[model samples]
Target: MTVFDDLVGQAQATAVLSRAAAAGAEAVAGGRGAGMTHAWLFTGPPGSGREEAARAFAAALLCPDGGCGHCDQCHQVMIGSHPDLEAVRPQGLSYSVKQTRELILRAAGAPTQGRWRVILFEDADRATESAANALLKAIEEPPPRTVWLLCSPSPDDLMITIRSRCRVVTLATPSTEAVAHVLATRDSVPHDMARFAARASQGHISRARRLALDEGVRRRREAVLAIPPSLTGVGECVSAAERLVKTAEEEAGVATAALNETETSELRKIYGEGSSGKGLNRGLVRGGAGALKELEDRQKSRATRIKRDSLDEALLELVAYYRDVLAMQFGASVELANDDHRFELDRLAQSSTPEETLRRIDTIMRCRERLEANVNPQIAVEAMMLGLRRP
Candidate 1:
């Protein structure tokens, strides 16, 4: 097997990266930077395996065999334990300039054991403006043996200076058939459920896996889909909005609760929480308050980001449902993404004009934009539900 094998439906990108990796092996051995770009930018839509692609590419470059997929070198890269590979994933909403400078300092060092140094940075788009500028400097003049792999949704998400300094590898959303095949073959999901989740996921591979296997995810989706039919009056619309926002919050809380507690506990222990010995760094113990406050701020930002992401997923599901209703109204021959809701789709299609469905879609899109602009979640969702209420 090769490092690129698990990258489903990205034949073109796999081929490009494979050739680059082959060239990279030669460059590393010959002590020449020929036939390899020092920096690469992986751009794709959500669930397009941007981070996975970066990780695989790092393995290929680090492995002596250009990614045999089973060697110790490849395994280390996968687990983020390779001495020469620096894999960074930003947990907070933004990566600060201070963090960027530190990362660049680490990247500037020579390789320890591996032939070349590699940095795989996920969510490169989350770098703050000042941080991006700092990153640009490092990418512009990276060490001869250093390689940078940055993943983002699009080239536009990064600065032009940084974009121009990197070779671009764009990945496309995998087809439903391809996603379903992977779900069945890799995740061992049953055929019928795999197809259903694949269709509903709208090309998001991770989401398809969750929908196919996670009962909580499935129930939450059902609740979101149940919103449209229940908006009979203003009060119902208000309640629907409340329910939608609350669901996002609940999911975020579940995701962050244990993580937040673990981090807090670790910080306390480090700061002499249960100390009894000559921890004569009482000054350091007193300094824990400031560090704790910083950690709290970061956790809050992370929670907010997760909550917004959860709400965005719900909004996208609503968009898909209305899109199916619009398709039914037009008598389109194409298959519906929400085919399981055929009864409701048909009823809504007959009761509403295509124009009305389009209006509702526009309203949902507006709500998504408002949320991105940092409008209060309750207010934005309420406005959307009110607009979605049928006349």
Candidate 2:
């Protein structure tokens, strides 16, 4: 399949980009029109293929055949080896001014391979104010043969000045059917498993893929989904809270340990263990310390975010369960998100009122807000569990 095929449920975005690329090519060939713009902003939710779309467009722009999937140009862009294409992905919490200046300097130069130079800012929302200002200046009056692509959750996530200067391409979340099709066709997963992952992920492609591939993920989800009916007392509420905290910690530990090891190895290589013999190499020591500090800081931030995201996923799962409960309460026969949990949900429907289920949904939403507001994830989850357990 083509790169465009990977962008599920984004037909409008694909059409807009295809047309733009075609028009740009035509302009170049006919020697007319206000040549291609130097900047583009791709806005979409996480796992919505915003960066993938940008890369595809970049490939098309560089390829003579308009992104023939098998061509050298397309292959190079896909693997990130294209000389004219540079992608800036933040390693730490945010892109620094130094990194933005480096990109700006590169953008000021002529293309090394293709007719135009391309710079992609993946997750531009992570850029610091100084970095954003530096990038803004570059976008304000880019070099003649330069093109910038910025990816973010939405146009509002970027500075108004920066947003006003670029063309915007928006992508919506894919449907469950689209996600299921992708899982079955691309990953060769079983149809039933693919459907369950698609429905449970709530339109997140990467999460759906993970849920399909990892048995542990599926098991964890099952455990979370089972919590609603079992939370019958204060002790059960505390136990649920403890379990969620432990799960988040385990996931965060796995993520951070891998990153920490990589960073530590890189730092050791840079320092070179007394090779200089210059009495401790204070500069190298300081640099290594700073890098470790930055790595740890970013890891802390990421851990917090991961916990909240994990909790949010659990909340969504709970919502789906309750929604089914509500439907059953109202004597509706609609399809359920957690059809596998039908027995448990049916029990809930019989035990609780529809109004109580709605209130539980509201509590889940407030828990999400609290997590977003930087409240302790464990505390927010604990309170949510307590509220869910109340009669």
Q: Which prediction has the highest lDDT against the true structure?
A: 1
Q: What's the lDDT for candidate 1?
A: 0.91
Q: Report the C-alpha lDDT of model 1 over 1-391, residue by residue, as the tens digit.
A: 9989989789999999998998888777775546589999999999899999999999998898989999999999989999999989888778999989999999999999757899999999999999999999999889878999999999999999999999999999999999999999999999999999999997789999999999889999999999899999999999999988998898889999999999998987897767744452563557877888899999998898899999999999999999999998888997688999899989999999999999999999999999978899999999999999953
Clashes of 1: 0
**Alpha-carbon local distance difference test for all models:** 0.91, 0.83
| Segments in model 1 whose C-alpha atoms lie over 4 Å from true places | 31-34, 276-286
User: Number of the top candidate by TM-score?
Assistant: 1
lDDT of 2 by residue, 1-391 (tens): 4557668899999888877777667765765535357799999877688998999989888888777778998899999999999988775546778878988987787887647788988989878899999999999988876889999999998999999999999999898899999999999999999999988787789989999999999999889987987788888988898898788788877877887778667766676654664533664566866776766776777766666667777777787788888998998977677778888888889988888999998888898888777787778888999989873
Clashing residue pairs in candidate 1 (N, C-alpha, C atoms within 3 angstroms): none
